[model samples]
Target: MKMNIKSLYAICTAALLAGCTDLDVNIESQYTQYPINDIAVEAKNADVYFHLRDVFGRRYMEAMSLSSDEYTAVSYGGGWYDSGCYSHPSLHDFRTEDASIDWMPTVISGITKANTVIRDLGGEEAAPADIAPARAMRAFFTFIIMDCWGDVPILDYLPVTNDEVVRAPRAEVARWIESELLEIIPQLTDEVSDNTYGKPTKWMAEALLAKLYINWAVYTASSVEQYEAATAENEKLNDCIRICDDIIASGKFNLGSMPYAEKFGPDNGSQVEDFIYAMPYDTYTATGMQYGRARTWKNAGDVEKSYYGMKLSNSAGGYITMNPEFSRLFCLEGDIRNNSVIGDTVHVYDPNTYQPTSEIALDENGKPIVLTQTVSLEIPDDVQLGVGDNTKGYSQGYRSVKFFVIDDDYKNGRNQSNDLPIFRYADILLTKAEAIVRGGTATNGETAMSLFNQIREYAQAPLLATTPSLQDLLDERGREFFDENWRRNDMIRFGTFENEYGFHKKDFPTARFEKTCRIFPLHRDVLNTYPHWTQNPGY
Candidate 1:
């Protein structure tokens, strides 16, 4: 596997990363041979992980947070009015290239790297154990692409021509991913150590399968226009339970292992035991993780030093705000998640020791800074967003503290060491409980109520007294995973993505049930590059 290149296929990699090859691409050039297989399986796999980091950044967050009911952002009178693209998700009135669409190429970049590793290793048959992780990661990237943009292309090898780049139907893509994951699961590592830290393991792969099964109906449905979330049923609900049971029985994860807030701080990494899979963003080495820009204020380094033990280098105050309806979920007495969402007024903490001080945070003219949970996303025409540096939100909505920062983060400026949790052990218990509630009898002796209460009881919140229903499970998911990028998926599954929450309504009523809005249409560039492809219905 020595290095050599100078082929159109090499150039096609760049094209594919930008999207599929253009129509004018010279198909015959793909015939030129190159000995570019110098990339090791591990190096190609590392590239896959790094490419995924770019995806979880800006555009993806706007789509996931801004679209869903969990959080929203507006002009705030000064900024965030990105020509109305920022509010398109909430309003359901979108133009091409909205935040939700660009991740296709970014995700494709990761998938292409994973595919290259598979191809260079002489295909999956030659080194099943040595290269199985790449196959697993490839499936993970495909899952994101499919979840976001319904019917999409599936590339197993480098295409020699544009004709090889046709889009696969959504159902076909899901089935192919399922078969690929099933074949590679045994080859995946079973350990949960540093060797497999950010990479997918047997448990994480199973978790992915369980997720696919639970959403089988939605993915395979002819159309979501008439879909009902309350009475939704999945034929693979039984399969989902079985997969979740295997992970739960392994005894590797525990909710009681750490305090609720500690699960997302700088100390939360692979060894934490609560996370099944996470994106390991670090302070000194890893980069591209800036949660402060989404939640913290601009002058936090000078104002609220009592926060995470370092002076934050940057912040985008009011760039995002919590929705009132979703904010009510944190009202349970003694729930740790409530402490993270700052509302009303509280004392300012000391910076040096990160301790509580007698001094309270006040706005410009000596007034207490208070956070509000207003029902409307609109601000009165005469009101202002930021008056002075000291204000927390005298006229603002609720703020968040998820994906918290710490002292080590000071070294990397705005970037943080907080490992982003994708799947957690609590999700396993909840998924199995949800599957059972949806008419799949648990093969194990565990009842739906027993498994469902594990998450709530451990979080120190009240436990459910009766059997959980679909709506109850939906509400519980909203509470458990607010800002972790799970809201859009849950909202779609529950048939609520089309409804207006906080910011969608400005002057008049805007909430209605629309099917096409369930999944975003293919990007404009994608549609134009491949003329044969049709836009999603009703787009």
Candidate 2:
């Protein structure tokens, strides 16, 4: 179905109205204008494409990062702090509301859009090329909700009434995600062409399956079944290995020879290592590539604005700095990943020349214009915060420059053009290595040690002579995928999320670390609307 601006507006208006009613009626009305017979194929495809973009925005990424031990909330001093830094109950105990609540509706809306595409395109009879990406997207969105909230309502088909809005078991949702990916892999395109660049492809389906299988126990296990859960978890780990083997053998992608920073550069859309999918962003057409703002230091803003012309709003609160432990994951000696961190020094530019200068610039009070403090892996007790403050010092934390910043001509007001990678070829190698160490077989041409060294080679770090333990693998993932939004999930899977890391003790001295913190509470407003909904355990 081809959608014009008028039809798009109509569908959006209907979705808003239906959102007030039953989930079924909501989805049904959202697709009323673009019925199967009336809509063009191009319109249906465009709808799915737009929703995929909407689903992969910065808010989702920042929320996941803040919830993990990947960052330490640096204070701006005088009691000023980023609300997002300390506002979530999961991140800091003093906050009353859950941050994940704000995300629920947006994610649910994405799923609804995916469903509309599948339904209007003829359901089971829809063309494989057209429906496969939509199915994969729906599965991906579902997996995220389940990963964050445990049990969520699964609206597979359009509903007739609101009575169907009941939470599905997490394990059941996991199984459905597994089944959906397995069923659609063959139908997805194997090649990476212009049409498939940001869309879900065959490799993405396999990657999603590998992720699901590897974290199966965390996703499905119950408190009552400890021993049984471990056994099932190991089996799922093996399944993860098999799926990863298929992805590695597909010959569609390989670990690129480019430096780590270059892989995330503005032109990264052309990088080969980006195996599964990327959320394509452009300054003009597709925007919201704001990871740079969330991670960049406030003092550096003037330099960025002056030199690069990139506007640094710092509006998402303040800079997201590495939790002392996460920063130490990088080998400062030769690891390229370590180069992403900015500390101590600020670049000085000549005002007239607008070029980088050797002399450090000074403020009116005679202090350095960009005051950078030595960032310690151990956060100071005095800066521990349960609320925002104005006194947080500027230089107390190390900033991440992982994402690419375009040339100085790039305007601050424009969104970045760097493509956000969802999955990479290096991740596949690490997944295989970890699976092997966990007792899964390696059938994809490389031993676990060899695969491990492949990444180390690119990182310019020393190779391992012996096989790595699970802890070593976890450390490697932290070093490699840091700031990419996988840390929280990795910490949970490794059983480290409940530990007192970073400044958690200072901020919430008496709080207990519990398993219920694994899945966040459903937003309070969502519960108020649907009285039948039950909150997660510890909310």
Candidate 3:
């Protein structure tokens, strides 16, 4: 809940900062070289919580989304190709060298930082209650590591080339994550206030468990076939549901505090009551992501601004567009989500004055911007024309205005003023609904249908008459949480990730439906450092 507690971050000793990185080859020796016995938890956690934002940089989101059905980043002949990287993503033909999914170092750095906090606080076994957040944090980032790479070294200690750092089996990692989360839940504070705004708390830890259990089969599977064999009837489903029920029963987050549309915006802060954990990306203090800028519209002549007047900082041309086919379901009669899903018109706003009149964004000829729902891996020359030429390829995908980008930060630059949701109450509703429908026992008179209807009722979408099929819940998750980084995770869980969607063309088959495609190969750069590590299956 530490939504922007950068104010509390104090300068730490250089030795502490020196040991917080995973890639700093000398980090371990340096930490052992100078140990701190009196480091403050708040100061160390500031470094720990701040790095959480780095987990999702522009490239990571692009790869994960493109690999899923989220959206496409095609080559405008020469536009987004980036030395053939874009080509691989759409075809699902990723390489060990692709920059996409190349942020492992950043993730490891986060874990290393958390470990430093735990070590300084007293070591993991005997760390005091105050370091519960750090323990939970280690579990949190470790989950991300396990999710991306099947088997990874658990850097719980500073290994000076620990030369012995070995990969833990995926199942063991899962069990460790589950056990670690349980151990710290009771130790974490339940108070909800500015003090816990962006930090880990009891509910946040539970939410992490809910996420881990929801995708348990995928994370624990040794091979693609094993993951594919998993069903909604996963043994962990009940635990996922139980944890979700506990979080819900606490009465901490509810729909009454904020409407569906109001939860994602620059002002969705501590008062909204739906965020279980959201990253606070302050322009000055914490990490500010390029998400808003990457999603901002940059269609025509020098026109580069979001619906809320947040200027597009990336001059690189193409912004994220929703798949037209995927976007169609947002048209449900009473669903207000459609309004923010993708606007038919680009409501032009003055970049300076930041006020909206009736004007529209225009191309070079001063014509109103034109957009198409169609997309392809490589736009034909005739259709695409050229990059930034206002042709089909230049503006093919629909721009999503779901997260209203506003100039609410210090320079109106891209900042956490528009905080991103890591987990929301709405996700919990769908989580339980899916679990019950998947054959987990429903409790407290709550049927999968009733729980499913809760999300629909909140969105003003028509309620489903009965329990939804797995596909319905999956599609509904797409419609409700699009562009929020859950699409790829959802698709993998539902067994549809290998299917072609967005730009992942069906014919460019390098590894379609092959179980190995489920988990990505560790990038060559990573292996080059630790040559002993094994790549994921079939890479």
Candidate 4:
């Protein structure tokens, strides 16, 4: 079924409030709008256009988080691992066709909408503003494909028929994105408008180009000449000294003045300082899906005396948690990100009203545990948690705080106003530092760690040695961008895609995956449906 604005909005609102319409909204279409002169017809098209834009952001975040870091693992106590979905048969192995399904349709659907908008706005009589959004949407979708699948079926020319579709190599896709951004940069407004703050400005295009170059080795193995070619394509990266430098000089974005926890912690409704581009969320609009809450176990009660929350008379459960290996990487002290993103404290919830009670402890195993003896919604203490031994089923696992649900308002398994950071300033600085390292420049004598220190300073963490090596940069990226969805690519870039990490990497099931696994398989559904389509090699 075609996704219309009303329908997409309805789903977001429904998910936020379980199922209710207490909050109502009428969003104007970013494309396909009725002209004031032709209000009725324009309104119809606008409605469809706006829904298309919504899907673009929604799908973009979900795909990136799942495919990249922005997540904790569940290996020990039935937790999710960064590579669990990447290598397991029943989980998410990108080596085969099945792993690409969930995100493929959403992207293709969004592309369809973008194509429609571009077509309608380009017709004989249409406002230029109507097409501005279309151009932006196109760039956004193409960027996703470029980053994720690498060599993708570029639909820039729009559909002639399914038979006409052909796959473009990774290098070509990258070029397309670079070209699209350059073409549209002039059309986009540089102003930091409210809803559009996280939207792509010309600077975002520049930053993205830097990111593309920084990871160029991972996408395609061209020699030094190819590397230089990528750098040449982005005059902006040079103009800004680095894309991050450009973003800072732009003076539009900043690190949050608040502490790290406030910036990425439970009480996340407040404006985040580092957001360059993000997906807007709003509780009142009833349109936010708190992935953070979804990843977190419902730990509101326990055994003592009804602990801290009202016991729902009944319950159904699902399993997801943090991996022990991934969690251990956080320093016990000094790194502020540990406290902000990973809270070791256990908050007991009152059974009468689900609020936290102060009591944190660790089990004999050294894992943190919460005491919820009194309430129905209880997250088990570590000693009692399920570790998939058939005795226990995986409880007491660490919950995700990346997008925390702080209050009953936009809180508790749902928060709308918490915008998803699509791009951040720190990302820029690190990308530039990496590019400089690879480009053979040590003029500053400041190595990758020096650049990493700049990002660390923003996170309020201490700096490493000023002239650390390339491996240090890779490790820092892992820690800093963990679960943020850059792992598969980073692994490839570091030449670790086939290698393992810690214990999990030892007995990985589908171990044939190599650097080639960096790119996802073309969707089987698409391949099967289109007769002339060809699959990627090694798939």
Query: What tens-digit string does per-residue lDDT give for candidate 1 at 1-539?
Result: 00111122233334332222222234354333223332334444565655666467556777777778887564454455565556666556555676555567667767766665565556635568767787888888888888877887887665554454777888898898899889989988889766566777898899899889888888887665645776666889898988998888888777756767767776677667788988877554566677656666434554444344444555544567777878888887777667667666744543333333466665434556567677333444312122222343324567776666554575566677677888888888888888898888877779888887888888788888999887778788887877788788888887777666775554434432466777776778776666788887768
Candidate number with the higher lDDT (1 or 3) = 3
Q: Could you tell me every candidate's TM-score relative to the true structure?
A: 0.86, 0.83, 0.88, 0.71
Candidate 3 least-lDDT 10 residues? 379-388
Per-residue lDDT tens digits for candidate 3, residues 1-539, read 43335445424322235445764445435444223344555666767775757556366667666667766655455665665564565456667988877877778878878777676666745455777888788888888878777787676676655555678888889899999899889999898777777779999999999999988877877555577634434779899889999988998887654556567655566666888887765555554556655554454324443345544443434545666667776778878676665445566644333334476666545666666666543433322222343355566777665555545452434554556778888899899998888778898788889988988888899989877998899889988888677887888899888776654545443425565676677888888877888787777
Please list the C-alpha lDDT of all candidates, in the order they appear. Answer: 0.67, 0.64, 0.69, 0.48
TM-score of model number 4? 0.71
Better of 1 and 2 by TM-score: 1
Total clashes in model 1, counting residue pairs 3 or more apart in sequence or in different chains: 0
Candidate number with greatest TM-score: 3
Sort the predicted structures by lDDT, highest score first. Answer: 3, 1, 2, 4
Over 1-539, each residue of candidate 2 has an lDDT whose tens digit, in order, gives 11132245334334431222124444544544544432354455554455545345565675677667777555454333545434343344423254424567766767776776777677777777778877888898888888888888786765555455778888899999998888999988888655466667888888888888878877777631231322545667678888888888877787777767777755566444554677766655565676765565554444434222344433333446666666667654787777666445544433333234565544223455442333332243344443233223545555666674554313545366667777787888898888787778777577888999988888888888989777888899888887777888887777777666556553454344666767676676677767788777765
Better of 2 and 4 by lDDT: 2
Candidate with better lDDT, 1 vs 4: 1
What lDDT is obtained when candidate 3 is compared to the true structure?
0.69
Give the residue spans of candidate 1 off by over 4 A. Answer: 1-39, 298-310, 349-359, 363-366, 375-395, 407-413, 505-513
